[model samples]
Target: MDRPQIPLNALRAFESAARHLSLTRAAVELCVTQAAISHQIKSLEERLGVNLFRRVPRGLVLTDEGAALVPVLTTAFDRMSDTLDRFMDGRFHETLHVGVVGTFAVGWLMPRLRAFEALHPSVDLRIYTNNNRVDLAGEGLDLAIRFGDGSWRATVAERLFSAPMSPLCRPEVAHVLASPQHLEGQALLRSYRADEWPRWFEAAQAPCPPLRGPMFDTSLALAEMAAAGHGVALLPVRLFATYLENGRLARPFEAEVETGSYWLTRLHSREPSPAMRAFREWLVDAARAADERPDLLRENALSATDQSL
Candidate 1:
């Protein structure tokens, strides 16, 4: 069976009109006169022998048939636009859309990204930052870097680095926290994760502080709040190194608790590309180098001294 021919101009006019529900606005978008837009729509309707839109006094409204077609047309147009955009570069390149946790991007990956760019100059990288919670397939993300227990069901996880939580506060507030137990009386800034504070306390063998402060979506936010003297935040020492090094924020004690390790994760069904493989290799090597740093008194690997931290 042969399909009927579709008028490109008429379809464009109808799609625009359907989107804005106004011929005038559609004309503005199409860069044509309103009369031209109306004529194209009418021509489309006459050719199809069906009413695509109902013109009310104020604006146009899509009929049931038009309403059903809008999404399909919109999706097709969007995909076409995206595909065409890649061809405009005149090179065969793959786009890797990666979603990274905010804390990791700021604390670790942002500084080291130049190395990856140097290696894979042809691969286009689009990074979306989220707060640990990510949708791999729904967001069309190739990879997600997050701190977790490696329990995500549909993803393959590769361990990157461990984040340890400890009491971090402004230097002025550090005096109030003489011991791990003293944290109980101070204002305890919290994360969205309910168990973080309690788990940290358990690891340090200290009493849990009364949870009373702003709950931050990211450790970076919590660290900033702590640096501003709002309250004490249980932060990943590795992530908040800049503040610690610059004396903006200070660790009250040496009590470090293993919160979770950062992981490079992707959908189990996602096939690996050369660019992805290179990135993974580079990331793993970086993680290993950080772990093997021969510096404690010599240099602060866990503190803000290491760029990867």
Candidate 2:
């Protein structure tokens, strides 16, 4: 059996008429006369040998054949429209999907995203946030910004920068801590990585206490908990600069321990697209600029102290 030769215009007319259930409204949308819309639909019905619609007194009702055909036509038209929308300024828009850790997404990347958008208007960048843990291939991600030592298996990881872990808490909590030893009595908030608090204690030359506080997967949540005076949380102080600057959280006893660095990672099996390359370059440049700004970091770390004094 041969496929029926149907005109695109007739199919469009039938689809519009079916959606509106009125030839007059469909004609208005299509910028054609009611008579022309009726003629196109009639021609489509004859080509398929089907009674697509039943003309009623109020408007129109679809038959069983029309009901089945509507979905097919709607899907086809939607896909066509989406494809056509990608073409802008005589070039096709390239899509780049990135998965970033929640901490980095909110604290670091959110501030600079507008810069990325301004630099690359042709790239459709989509970002998804997760905890530090992510599956690049499993989640169908083109790239992932993760916080850890660049040692994941089957991945090409580029070190962005290291954010040292430090103790951040509310002003009232910091006021009581003249020395690191005072933290032993306070509730110590913990991350899924159990060794962070212990490592931080070692850096401060204080005895490590048995941690029993609430554990969180994301640093963003842990930082919020600390800011709310739940307990002292060990976090990346540089990343949480906004909170520090605003006096919501304060870093006490400036003893920061380096546990891991953030990395830009992608599956080794996957090839990088042009959009991905552009994003990678921009991110690297941004990270470098941030690293060169030690004065900014110092200002944020000291802002809470200045406010309290």
Candidate 3:
């Protein structure tokens, strides 16, 4: 079957006139004479063998045929315009899809996204947050930022930094926790990783309590629960610094247990794109800068001085 030829200009004129319900208004919008708009619409209606508009005393009224055609033309034009806008200075925009753990996504990555966008204007970065557990291949993700030992099968991983686990709770809870031993009586909030609390307790040289508390999949939720004074949650303090600084959460002890590190990972078989390479480099530098904070340096210096004495 062959399709009949339709003039794009006539379609545009009809659509504009149908929207405004006035030939004069359509002509003003299209920068043409009122007579030209009317002629185009009349020609279009004749070609289709239908009455598109009925001339009323004050304005035009769309016939049943005109109403049916308006929505289809409007949608097509809008999609075409949106697609065309993606090309800038003859270069097509590249989209970078990243899946990140909810904890890192909220606590760290989101805050630094503006800097990434400013530096890489041509790359459209899209982030999907997940609970640490992610399938890079199944989800069609370009990269995954995970918190673990970086030993997943068929995946290449680059270490970001170690985020040690520590007991964090509300200000009221911290005041009661005068020592590591005091945590034994409190409601210790837990995550799916059962060994985290035990390991943190060992680091503090405190006796581990009976494993009993509500479990969470993500640290972000656990931190929120702790902030609300539900229980003491073992969290990555580096990521939840804002919560600590704002007094919503507090670390009762300085002891922290290094269970795992955050890593930038992707399928080992997949080749890196230009955008991926740029992001990887930028992220590594950012992490290094974050690790070398002035407070951390001073703490290290003080520890060294005490050891010398």
Candidate 4:
């Protein structure tokens, strides 16, 4: 048995006519005569055994069936057009869509994207940034880079690197902190993860302070708050290297706590596309190279003057 074939020409004609509500306009758009458009639509209706349009005094109106069919055809045609447009220099550039956590995207990935592009000229990379939270399948993403313990349900994860959190604050705030114990008295900004501040304090061998301040979902905003003297934010120091370099923020303590690490993840059921596989290979290799950096410092300690990381 064979599935009934859908006429591509009829779909195009019906979609155009439904959009403009005029056969004459559809003919102008398709560069065909009005009679040809009408004949195609009549044949389509006969094949489907449904009245697609309701002809009225002024113009045409779509029946319920036509309304249902038009959107599907329109989307299909637009996607086909977009794919055709990707052909360049006798090469068809493949598109790979990915989602990323805002912190990693801004602090790490942005700097290295140029190198990835240089390595894979035929792979077009598209990134959608989130606040360490995303639905990969729902968002139609090929992969997502996020900070976590690599335990997201229904996801297959590959570890990128550990990005531990430590206390970061403005210069004036840093001037007061003589020891991790002293942080007990300062304003502490926090994440939704209530354990981060307490866990960080525990790592420093200091009593956990009564944490207080505005909580943020993204480290980008948290870093900004700390830089502006609002509070000390527990953040991944390596990710915010520019802040330390530009004197916008400083690590007040050598103590750090591991909440999670950056991981490259994709849905367990999704088979890797060619472009996705290329990106993953390039990304993993790049991360491995960064891991070998002498100035990467330890996860529990960091150097402020190690040539700005």
Candidate 1 accuracy as TM-score? 0.70
Report the error of model 4 at residue 104, Å.
Answer: 0.6
User: Against the true structure, whose TM-score is highest?
Assistant: 4
RMSD of each: 5.7, 4.3, 6.9, 3.4
Per-candidate clashes come to 1, 0, 0, 0
Q: Which regions of candidate 1 fall more than 4 Å away from where they truly are?
A: 1-91, 294-309
| Rank order (by lDDT, best first) | 2, 4, 3, 1
Tell how far residue 234 is off in model 4, in angstroms.
1.2
Query: What local distance difference test score does each model get?
Result: 0.81, 0.91, 0.86, 0.87
Instruction: Give the per-residue lDDT of model 2 (tens digit) for 207-231.
Output: 9988895789889888999999899
Candidate 4 lDDT over 105-161, as tens digits, reads 999999999998998888888999999779999999999998888999999999999
Model 2 whole-model lDDT (C-alpha atoms): 0.91
In order of appearance, the predictions have TM-scores of: 0.70, 0.75, 0.69, 0.86
Using TM-score as the yardstick, the better of models 1 and 4 is 4
Show where candidate 3 strays beyond 4 Å. Answer: 1-85, 294-309
| Residue 160, model 4: Cα distance from true site in angstroms | 0.5
Give the lowest summed-lDDT range of ten residues in model 4.
300-309
Candidate 2 vs. truth: CA RMSD? Answer: 4.3
Q: Write the per-residue lDDT of candidate 1 for residues 175-281, one digit (tens) a residue.
A: 66667888777788988889988988888887785787568788888888888888888887777666777878777666677868999999999998876887788
Candidate 4: how large is its RMSD? 3.4
Question: Could you arrange the candidates by TM-score from highest to lowest?
Answer: 4, 2, 1, 3
